[model samples]
Target chain A: TQLLEQSPQFLSIQEGENLTVYCNSSSVFSSLQWYRQEPGEGPVLLVTVVTGGEVKKLKRLTFQFGDARKDSSLHITAAQPGDTGLYLCAAPSYNTDKLIFGTGTRLQVFP
Target chain B: SAVISQKPSRDICQRGTSLTIQCQVDSQVTMMFWYRQQPGQSLTLIATANQGSEATYESGFVIDKFPISRPNLTFSTLTVSNMSPEDSSIYLCSVSGTSAYNEQFFGPGTRLTVL
Candidate 1:
């Protein structure tokens, strides 16, 4: 089985600060997806990185896929209090529809 | 994109009881997945529900504990049987997209507390 581990299990920052979270895997994958989940809600898809070295941006957030396709990162610029949530990275399980999710990063931005 | 919804947003139940959560999608999907998450943690996939077959559970989960029913292309149900404190968590319903990248959308989740 493939494993995904995320770094900096918890993060707390003041509003307007910038931060980055990472997700690493034990094996290469075809694609990777990023999600942010707020309290009482399920995770919402943020972006999907299909190719190695791919980068996608959503408003103040930026996502990058490692050149080897074995890792990924999410960068938040000028974070706001609304950005506080649990961030996760996931990939399809060997071409199957099932997903294997990351350990998770909890970000709290206090305004 | 597929819009997903789950029933019984939050429920507190007694031990040894059972709870059935329903999931509905606005559009047809090939596979629907069930996941469990702690209050402030990540997702752990429980099983994959296909329209016309039995659900495929992951390693740590069993059918007896999480019986799934996919009655149609756009609806599914997950039941937590003989609940215990350890079963207290958020259960989410997800459906895979048809894109080449295979994006997935999630429901609002059902917060379950077994006391």
Candidate 2:
């Protein structure tokens, strides 16, 4: 079984601060995705990293896939109140057609 | 990416009753997935809805409890049958692009509250 563990399950930071969330797993994956979900809503895909050691950025948010494809990271720079939400990492199964999601990190960026 | 919509954004139902949530995607998608998210917990995949074939459920989930149907490439439904208080959660439907590895777009989600 492949499981993704996310560190710092909950985080509270003031505006302009920066923070990073980590997602680690024992099994390698072909691709990994990051999502941000607000209350009473489904997660919206932020980015997908397929190549190992790849880094992608969306405005102030940056996502990185580990060199081994077994870990990933999401970093938010100069956080704002709008950045407050739940961050999730998901890796689609290689042999099967399913997505394994990480534990998730709930971030609160206060103004 | 696709724009997906789900019906009954939030509902309150009695235990032992059932509720069927509908999912519609803007574009045709090959794969649709159902998921459940309990309070303060991560998402858990319930099943994969196939266009023409029967839905494939994951462990700890059965068709008898949560029946899913995908009649076409752009739509699907998930029925929570014989619900209990524990079944109260946010149900989301997701659709993958052309390939399984493609990024998935999710619906707004149906928040079910079983009394």
Candidate 3:
């Protein structure tokens, strides 16, 4: 079974602080995605990285796919209280449309 | 992107009871996925629902416990039978986009609390 492990299962930081969350897996994936989920809501797509060593930026958030396609990372610059939520990394299953999600990193940006 | 909606946004039910959650997508989709998110945990894929076919469940999940129905391309239902305290979680419905890269779009999610 393929699994994606996330570093720092929980994080609590002051507003304006920057943080990085890593997602690593022993198996390679065709594509990787990042999602942010707020309380009482499903996760929202943040970005998708398909190529090895690919980097995509969305405003204050930057996402990178590792050179081997077995890892990814999400970095938030100057996080705000609004950024507090659960961040998850997911990859598509081989020969299937299903997605395998990481354990997740819960971020709490307190003011 | 498709607009997805789940019925019974939140429900509180007694243990041993059953609940069926409905998911509707604005646009027709080829594949619909059901996921479970335990409190303070990431989403785990429960099964994949396809129109006119038996739903494919992931390992550790069985068809008897989680029955899924996909009568059409735009609608599906998932029933949690004989629920217990461990069944309390957020159930989310999602669909993969038709583009080259299959990006998933999710519904607001149905929060289930078994008492």
The C-alpha TM-scores of every prediction are 0.97, 0.96, 0.97
Q: What global local distance difference test value does model 2 have? A: 0.91
lDDT of 3 by residue, A1-111 (tens): 889999899999999999999999999999999999999888898999999999999999999999999999999999999999999999987887778899999999999
* Model 3 residue-pair collision total: 0
lDDT of 2 at A5: 99
- The candidate, 1 or 2, that scores higher on DockQ is 1
In candidate 1, what are the lDDT values of residues B1-115, reduced to their tens digit?
8999999999999999999999999999998999998889888889999999999999899999999999999999999999999999999999988887667899999999999
Best-first order by DockQ: 1, 3, 2
Pairs in steric clash, model 1: none
Docking class of 3: medium
Against the true structure, what is model 1's DockQ? 0.84
Instruction: Locate the minimum summed-lDDT window of 10 residues in model 1 chain A.
Output: A91-100
Q: In what order do the candidates fall by lDDT, top score first?
A: 3, 1, 2
How does residue A106 of candidate 1 score in lDDT?
97
Interface RMSD of 2: 1.3
- Cα lDDT tens digits, model 3, B4-111, are 999999999999999999999999999999999897799888999999999999889999999999999999999999999999999999999876666799999999
In order of TM-score, best first, we have 1, 3, 2
Q: Which stretches of candidate 1 lie over 4 Å from their true place?
A: none
Q: DockQ values for all predictions?
A: 0.84, 0.76, 0.79
